[model samples]
Target: MSDDLEILLTNDDGIRSTGIRALYDALSEHANVTVVAPASDRSACGRSISHAVDVHEHDLGYAVEGTPADCVVAGLAELGPFPDLVVAGCNEGANLGEYVLGRSGTISAAVEAAFFDVPAIATSLYVPADDETPYYEFDVTTDDFAEAARVTTFLAEHALDAGVFDHAAYLNVNVPLPDGDPAPIEITRPSKRYEMDAERNGDAVHLTDRVWESMDPESLPDPEGTDRRAVVEGRISVSPLTAPHATNHHEILEELAAAYRSQ
Candidate 1:
């Protein structure tokens, strides 16, 4: 990292999202920040990309008429002045567990950056979902993201010097709302839980996820060391992650290959 680092900032949420605005304000203080993000909300888009994306300059940065992954790719390849670091999100919802990471546009942007050999951070807020209060009901104001912005700023300032990215490609950060001052930060791994429920309503098939039920502070069964548990306990969860690839060697596959050669 240089004394004056070029930082590329993006998010699944639109350019107008409070989370991104908060991030831009905080990060600009420390680095030469450039924002290239989606023109509209493109959550849960994963690593899907568009080779030809329309880009327009805005007051904050360039807005792409595409997904978060598209923004990262376009920003790196054509936007010029390659970034020293890429920071995605302050996403509207928490991207926890290994399951959501594959589907989240926020996490996918970071993954795309990792493929480019540039370190990145994906940050999101964990708003507890409830029956009375819907998941999207939380007010994602700029003030609500202050704690997340602070943590991101700190990491951008010191993570490389601290050699944090040596072992991991990027970080998946989930922050609980700040109760009073800033919340404590915790290093965690994604929780292991697969809860996919589906129901039929009239002629339509409705998918229901009860995962949030377990994320409640009182009822959370997530272990103390997991990301979900940390957020439920009012702590910011930072899960060091790598891009998707097969690392484990399989003896069964090798045996099959040997049998094919014998044939």
Candidate 2:
């Protein structure tokens, strides 16, 4: 809990989102937090980058008219102080399943930081959705982010010194609305369940994620030790993951190379 720690805070939900503000306030108490986030809500924008973006000076920090990845690049390269860690989100929605990893702006921001060799933590809240009222439509307040802020602040204070980064590039964290006791933290992995439905109309194809229908305790298809299940049961899910994808050499490719040389 060193007050001297430098943290670069960014999020996919824009600078004014309650989630980011809650996180900024929480992290500010423990470290030097510089909020370099998008100027508008850029949810699910993934790792999209901009060639050039406008920047504005805000009371919290700098706001960029670009994607979350751009905010991170700008913060690290030009704007804020060089940081010890990058914390993205307290995101409006959960970035839970493996399918969402490449398509979540919150997670992408953390992945970008990981590529820079800086450890990061991307936090999101698992807001359950029903047939009538979705989580997005709920009047989510700053208080809703309190637990996420607490979890993130604790990680920021201790993770680096504890050598957690040696085992992981970044951590993708998902928390649910608080229940009786504080939610238990579980080391988990992104669930592999992917359910997409595409219905063709006259000239349009409406796509839906069928997985949302199963978010309830009775319907969740994911098992224990998975992100979705942890959150569904009111537990905090933390997936310690690597940044770059892995690759391996194979004899088939080597043989092809040898044959090409003969030609």
Candidate 3:
């Protein structure tokens, strides 16, 4: 399995990010891996792409001065060997809910790979806020991603032969921070719980995602089998997802189109 596999790796975090490096080290042991990632942190940068950008050589791989999506495009089309799979991240924070999918650079990179007809996995670390230290302020080193790297490497090695990609284009994986033991892996769907709040004060509108504030394991609003629920409860959440928006036939739209021709 190690000799035949080639994995194109990229992340929303910059090329030098410890999370990506951990992934590079772990996955490399099982497959030929290349890292073509943004030169700087391009977090939350959806599917935005760069038409023209600079690329530089790095010890890991090529560092692109562009977004995560751009890194995928460049990796697949240029710098890397056509890969067996595209693996994005080991990101610093979780990309959990359905609402965050469109905004998360980690998910966006996986979606970009899906568009190319390649199986992909986007991995993120769900860091819970401790009583004394805030999650946002917590500093995670490369060593912290060992569990995530181990699990991701296992999936990368076996998911293809197990028919995982035949069911969905990509997998969105969120793992809790390594605590007592490696977390149990759970198959889940992206949680639909949304708590976006906007307040106007003077000329400024403060936007907040209250979901982050409500991640108590004992009192979480999310039900079982949801990505948010699993991660908060110390489980690895792997959500099988498809790229591109799903659409359905609409009779109302068809009637409107027919009536517009007469006008």
* lDDT by residue for model 2 (1-263), tens: 78889999999989999999999999999899999999999999999999999999999999999999999999999896989999999898889899999999999999999888989999999888889998899888888898999999999998999999999999999999976578889999999999989999999999999888888798778988999999998999999999897788999999999999999
lDDT of 3 by residue, 56-171 (tens): 99999999999999999999998879899999998998988989999999999999999999999999988887557666578898778988898899899889999999999999
Q: What's the count of clashing pairs in each model shown?
A: 0, 0, 0
Give Cα distance to truth, residue 61, candidate 3, Å: 0.3
Model 1 over residues 157-245: C-alpha lDDT tens digits?
Answer: 99988999998899999999888878989999999887979998999999876787666688788888999999989999999988766
State the lDDT at 239 in candidate 1. Answer: 95
Q: Candidate 1: minimum summed lDDT over ten consecutive residues — where?
A: 208-217
Please give the lDDT score for candidate 2: 0.93
How far is 83's C-alpha from truth in model 2 (Å)?
0.4
TM-score of 1: 0.95
- Per-residue error for 245 in candidate 1, Å, reads 2.5
TM-scores for candidates 1 onward, in order: 0.95, 0.96, 0.95
- lDDT against the true structure, per candidate, is 0.90, 0.93, 0.92
Model 2, C-alpha of 159: deviation from truth (Å): 0.6
Sort by TM-score, top down from the best: 2, 1, 3
Alpha carbon deviation, residue 222, candidate 3 (Å): 0.9
